[model samples]
Target: MQRTFKSKIGILTHILLLITIILLFYSMWIKSIVFLVIMLIINVLFVPSFIHTEYIFNNNMLYIKSGYLPVIKIKLDTISEIISHPKKNSLFTTNPTKRYALSSDQIILYCKDNRRIAISPYDKEGFIRETIKCNPDIKISE
Candidate 1:
């Protein structure tokens, strides 16, 4: 069984996208080559990425995808624990984690090798349920 989950786009990202587009049009109207180039780069590289981020679960593997970036693949069985609503920038937490989430609230997947990956799916509960269905032995932290 294969399932696809879209990442939750945060308000900040939407605001940034709006600003970028406004500036892009403004730059074009004024014929400013420098601003146009900068806006184009941001629009091409950053905006699409946040808007199109998604996670795919298929055949015991989870694939994380964003615009233009390479896909991240993880084995479902390798996940050891899942942390919901992790505290951000806590001084006590020194553990390094890779984040693919666009929102502030995220789910963290801890793998067998101590690798941590953060993600934010639109349906957090459903994502957890599906993940548990795939890997029953995985631990969950509220």
Candidate 2:
């Protein structure tokens, strides 16, 4: 089965952006209009860049691919461990706010080569189920 995941844009983020745009327009600032227009263009043009991320599992290997500038592919053999757990409040506060709904369950991939990829999937349970199906040995924690 081919599974696809897409990060959704948050309602609050859009509202903030709209407010900024309105404020900029009301200020009669050319620079602000230019910046807002540029941002709008970027947002419209970048949908395909993030729309469909693919994960394919076959023959004891998991293939992961992300969209956009530099496409990446990682094999299952390189993954040392997969973990699911809640993120610390301090960590969440320190990170930059995202445009999507905040995730409570964070997925951490510890690679055999000493690399780590952290992802906070929107559907935590589904992500865990799918991931465990690919590699049953993966440890998942609430």
Candidate 3:
């Protein structure tokens, strides 16, 4: 069985994004309807791509895949730790800032070489339990 975890943009966040897009389109200083339209289109297109993610554990390895640009996969044995913590900034951005992964659900996976991957699981507790069951040696912090 393939387990999937989808990260959803909160309703409030989506509303805020729409309002921002409208305001940007209406603003005379940066009056570029085309730009605003393009942004809106991109945002709408991007949401669905992130709505479904899959994590497969098989043959002593774990695979994490998303329906977004630049797919990713991680091996289970290489994972050093799994931490449940709030991130400060959006994961899509390169800037380092504090942002919550999910308002109420977040996890940070640290790899063996110090690489970190953050995810906002839909069912945080269940995911944790399942992860632990798969890799008992992996550390988990609540």
Q: Pick the candidate with the highest lDDT.
A: 1
Candidate 2 lDDT, 45-139, residue by residue in tens = 54443444444455656455444434444566567666566467533543332112223335566667766555555565676676677677665
Pairwise lDDT winner, candidates 1 and 3: 1
Candidate 1 wrongly placed segments (more than 4 Å): 90-97
Task: Please give, for residues 84-134, the per-residue lDDT of candidate 3 as tens digits.
Answer: 764445344422222223333557777797677766666777777777776
lDDT (CA) per prediction: 0.87, 0.53, 0.60
- Residue 67 of model 3 has an lDDT of 52
Q: Which wins on lDDT, candidate 2 or candidate 3?
A: 3
User: For each candidate, what TM-score against the reference?
Assistant: 0.90, 0.56, 0.65
Off by over 4 Å in 2: 8-67, 89-105
Taking every candidate in turn, the Cα RMSD to the unseen true structure, in Å, is 2.3, 5.1, 5.0
Taking all chains together, the TM-score of candidate 3 against the true structure is 0.65
